[model samples]
Target: MDLSALFSLMGKVALITGASKGIGLSIAEIFAAAGAKVVISSRKQDALDEMAGQLRARGYEVTGIACNVGNMADLEDLVKKTVDLYGTIDILVNNAASNPVFGPVHDTSLEAYDKIMEVNVKAPFHLMKLCFPYLRESSNASVINISSIGGISPEPGLGIYSVSKAALISMTKVFAKEWGDHKIRVNAICPGLIKTKFSEALWSNDKIMAHMMKALAIKRVGTSEEIGAAALYLASPASSYTTGTVLTADGGFTI
Candidate 1:
């Protein structure tokens, strides 16, 4: 295989949710740079507009669509809009997630658990179903779910979120197996302790950061860009024949 061709995302139309900032935005940026026409979404239109404008100025093909993934109507509209503008959805990145509860599983309220499951687990499932037609049309279809290391191993004060993520991993496998015949590759990316606003609780604390330094083989935290690169690999032809796999980019933290 030609080295450039293996990783090129040219002509692909990618829809990435929770893409205004953090891991989602990083993946969208990288996808656009790799030649994919990317449609990015977040709960806020202004933020999405800003991100899209910045990426376009860099000579990348991008569009901003504000959609709260928690709502099925929003998800349906997100897929419809993508297809309307791009003709098809070649890639779907279910990166939008919620972690509302920060207590023991036993102490978590029903409301908190519902919100966590709604955004982190249920949203992705519905989004995939909504985009199934468009994804089926693309010969190079791919779905990248942004799971977490917490899913693989429980995290203190993040019990509910971890459970949702664990469900997402299972969902990835289920879809990958079922969609294999359709040639729609599905996978999950488990990022570990990335230094983003979403993970500030862990990286921002001096004591927590100190402990993480000694725990990780790299002696440092990971970045959203690192996870984005991993997404690119799974999204591109370079990862052809790879599906139903959980690619953990955790700075050897799991080891």
Candidate 2:
């Protein structure tokens, strides 16, 4: 079988959140390279504009929209703008998330919990709803929730953040079931210890990296591009038969 044929995303229209940098940005680049019209969103307009310009310079079709996923109005606007520009949202990658606090669960506060839930959980749900019309219209549609490996198992120090991701995973399953009739596939990617700004604390320290390596089968931190490739598979025709699945890219941390 020519496996590459299944992975092609050419002419697809993809909308990605938290796309100014890291995994989100990498996904944007990969999808664009594969000939998709990519729409990137983040809270920072300047950064999103810069990234969009850079991608356009490389001959990719791209657009940038400043969106704070926590705000329903912003999400509505994001969906409207994408549809206005491209007429449809073939793929939605819910990659925006938050980890405002660390330490034990008991030490976490109501404010922190709410904050994390608003971005990590609620926002994705809202975005899905707002984009449902466009997604339903497409012959091929996919929704990818960027969850974390912490949600799959547990991380004592990550408390509420972990809880939020767990809820996201649950949301993926529910949405997958509800949207199946529309031929829209909903799934999640639980990334392990990736070398990104969001996980600098874990991989930046040599001692922590050494300890983490012991538990990982790959014995190293994962990269954003690695996660990007995984996102590509889930978002493209490659994973046409896949849905309601949580694809883990954590370097075998769960093993």
Candidate 3:
């Protein structure tokens, strides 16, 4: 097998959600640089526009669409727009997620719990459903779900979010089995604590940082580029045989 073919994502179209900043945006950037026409979505159109413009300036084919993953109609519109722009969706990175509440499980309100599940798990599942047909047509179709190490092991003050991530991991397995016949490889990326704005609540806290310093083998938080690199591997041919797998990119936080 040619080694270069393993990492190539040329001639593919990828859609990423929660792509205005942090890991989602990084995935969009890396996917575009890998030669895939990328569609980025998030709640804010202005942020998406900026990201898309930056990627396009770098000579990659990229478009931005605003989407609130919690809304099914928005999801439908996102799919329609993606297909309209690129004709088909070859790759999908469900990187959009939420954790609106932070406290004990007992203190969590019903609304917060529902919101967490809606964005973190349900949205990914439904978006994949919407893209199933287009994904099936591609010989190199892949679905990369962004889960978290918090899902693998319970984290302090993050109850519902962890549960949702765990469900996402399960969803990844189920879809991998169901879609395997169509040659669509479904996988989950469980990132360890990355140093992104989305994770400021953890890293910005002095106590949490000290705790992580001792628990993590890598002795530092992960980077958005690190997650982006992992997404590229799973999105490209490098991971052709990898499916129904949770590729954890946390700085060895589990260990």
lDDT of each: 0.93, 0.92, 0.92
Q: Candidate 1 — what's its lDDT?
A: 0.93
Query: How close is every model to the real structure, measured as TM-score?
Result: 0.98, 0.97, 0.98
lDDT of 1 at 249: 95
**What TM-score does candidate 1 get on C-alpha atoms?**
0.98
Query: Tens-digit lDDT track for model 2 on 124-225?
Result: 998999989889998889999999999988775788888889999999999999999999999999999998998887778788778888899998789999
Please give, for residues 1-255, the per-residue lDDT of candidate 3 as tens digits: 786678888999999999989999889888888889999999999988888888898899999999999999999999999999889999999999999988899999999999999999999989999999999999899999999998899899999999999999999999999999999999999998898988999999999899999988899989999999999999888888989999999888887
Instruction: State the TM-score for model 2.
Output: 0.97
Worst 10 residues of 2 by lDDT: 2-11
In model 1, where do residues sit more than 4 Å from their true spots?
none
lDDT score of residue 198 within candidate 2? 85
Relative to the unseen true structure, what is the C-alpha lDDT of residue 179 in candidate 3, on a scale of 0 to 100?
Answer: 93
Error of model 3, residue 131, in angstroms:
0.4
Clash pairs, candidate 2, are none
